[model samples]
Target: MRIALFNDYRIGSVNGSRVADITEVVDTRWHGTPYVINEFIAHWDQINPSISAAMDRADTHELAGVRLLPPVPRPGQILAAPANYRAHVSEMTGSRHRPANAQALLSPREVGFFVKSPGSVSGPSDAIELPPIPGRSFHHEVELGVVIGKPARGISRERAREHIFGYLVLLDMTMRTDGEHQEERTMRKSFETFTPIGPFLVTADEIADPTALRLRLWVNDELRQDADTADLIVGVDELIERASAVVTLQPGDIYATGTPDGVGPVEAGDTVRAGIDGLGEMSIPVTERGW
Candidate 1:
């Protein structure tokens, strides 16, 4: 089922152009607090039996025309894997470092994960702010975001899919070479409005094979990255299995499973869109920020 968190944190179950305001059904019990998508998944079975029964319900209320937020407003953690795709690795090979050597030099073999500041999160229609930091280069990394459904630790690669709640398209906006420290990538990736996620969350049952989806990104309407998740060096199952070995994967945790080739930059007034088939798309505008 396609689920979305709309204006003012209202929940909706998508049906073509129409959106059923599950907000009433959801808010009837848990009122006043900002409801995150994870809350719906956690309580739907017990709180609303109708929701659990129908994936496509009719629009019950007037749809609110507003911006979509990252389904999880306050995810416990946002863990992202870098250079996990073979083609992306190939692109970074000659200049960044050879993929053969990255495993050791860049710690790719260590299962490296970068933590994006949760405040960096934005939605499909949100404007991406280009903070005027001199001598900086910003790049867009289109990634497939994985949302955790239940709490798990030390999950096996074979059973990883069982722990997944849903998927979302992610734009891992980064500020390359931020100069905070020459040794880390997080410096450029943790800026405000750097991550654009959503449109809607597609439940795991809808996507039978996560590794088979096509992922792509277009900058100002020009296709730059076009690669499938099948190109991933360490697929989703392995990523979850590996990450679980280090930290517990909570119900609201998010993991951006790396981007493919075609990494580039965007300035203010630019449009960036990324998506995965069967999942959904996210389009964000770029705006310059002074100071």
Candidate 2:
């Protein structure tokens, strides 16, 4: 089932062009505080039956006019892979005049991952705010976002799938410059409005294979990124296992499985649309942060 947060953070199950409100299905009073995304995911299994029942009811709203927010507005962590795609790595290395040696094509085990600030998260309708730093070129990295369903630590690669809640289309908006170093890379990436995720959170059961999906991104009408997840140097399972070994994967944590090549700079007034085959697509506007 497709789950979404729309029109004032109300949770609902999404059908074609319609959404059945299921916000009341789960008991949201968490010892006086309203149930947040993390609490909701913790109780998902128990509340799922009621959500399904709510979807069957006649009371529904049109999906088109509703405003959709990031499925998890503020996740506990946002783990992201860098240079995980062979083509993407090659493009970076060749452009920088680095030798395309075996050392350059590091595996996921070697490259590890980086943590993006949760404050960078934004929804589908939100604008990709371009930072005003001169000489900084903003680019879009379309990736398949993985949402964790349960808390896990040191999970095995064999059982990694059990922890996943679902998937979504994620755009890792970035600022790049020539000859950027490691520390500069993280600083540029952590800017506000850098992560745009949403449209829908497709349940994992609905997806046949996460590693076999096609990812595509466009700047206005021009296609900038086009590649398959099959090209990933380190697939989803290993990403979860390896990441979880270092830090506990909480229910509302998100992992962006890196981007393929064809990443290029975007300017103000550009509309960016990115999608994963079954998950969904997000089209967000780009605007300059007036300095």
Candidate 3:
């Protein structure tokens, strides 16, 4: 099922040209659960049956023509895996560098991860604000966002697929700056309005294979990043497993699996659109904001 948050945070299911009001279903008994974005994830099975039944009995309502919100507007945490793409890692650390030294140069870890404050998230088609900081380079990284369904830890790559809930497209907006120390790499990358995810949540079951999807991004109508998830250096299952080893993967938690090459910048007034083949697309306008 394609789950979405729409019309002033109302919980609904999407149908062709229409959005059914299941807000009543949640209101009748699941009031404490809140939006479909929140409960459909945290208690997937709990509401799955009710959601399915609601879809069957839904009364058609004129499409609200409402906008979509990041599938999870307030994910507990947003874990971003940086440079997980082979070519991206090479571009950051010259290709001549060794893996061990590359890890040191990046500083976070061999994998180099960062946390984007949940408040930084905005939906696709939303506006992106450029912070007032001068000389800081801001770049866009389009990535595949993995949504967790079940809680997991110390998971094996082979078993990672079992814990996944769904997938969404994400833009990991980055702010670049040299760290305090000469050899350090603590850049303030996780900035507000820096994470753009969703248009909708494409349930995992709807997709046959995650790695086979085509991912692309365009800025102001010009293609900037074009690639396939098949080209990923470390695939989805491995990433979930690797991350589970370090931290428990809880329902509603998200992992941005990194972006492909063609990293670039966008200034105020630019429109950035990105998407995956089966998943949906998101177009966001760029605007300037004061620090």
Question: Which residue window of length 10 is worst by lDDT in model 1?
Answer: 97-106
Q: What are the Cα lDDT values of the candidates? A: 0.77, 0.84, 0.75
> Which stretches in model 2 have alpha-carbon errors above 4 Å?
30-35, 56-58, 96-105, 179-183
- Write model 1 residue lDDT over 1-291, tens digit each, in one string: 787777778777776766776665554545434555667766545645777444355454433465566677778789989778776766666544222333332323465677888788888867888988776767888989999987779999999988898998888988755333343567568787888888888889899899999988998999999999898877898888888988999887899998888998898888998889998877788899765
Model 3 C-alpha lDDT per residue in residues 1-291, reported as the tens digit of each score = 777776566666777668776665553454324244656677777777787677778755554477666778888878877666667755666432223333443322365466778788888657888887765656778999999988979999888878889999998887654433222222345567788888888889988998988889999999999988897777788878778888898888888887888888888888999999888888899899766
Q: Look at candidate 2 and give me any clashing residue pairs.
A: none
In the range 1-291, model 2's lDDT, one tens digit per residue, is: 788887777776888898887776656664222235567787778877676666676367899978888888878899999889988987877664233332465656797888899999999979999988775578889999999998989999999999999999998888766544323456778888898899888889999899999999999979999999999999999999999999999998999999999998899999999988988888899998766
Model 3 poorest 10 in a row by lDDT = 178-187
Q: Estimated TM-score per prediction? A: 0.88, 0.92, 0.87
Local lDDT at 1 for model 2: 79
Q: State candidate 3's TM-score.
A: 0.87
Tell me the deviation in Å of residue 286 in model 2.
0.5
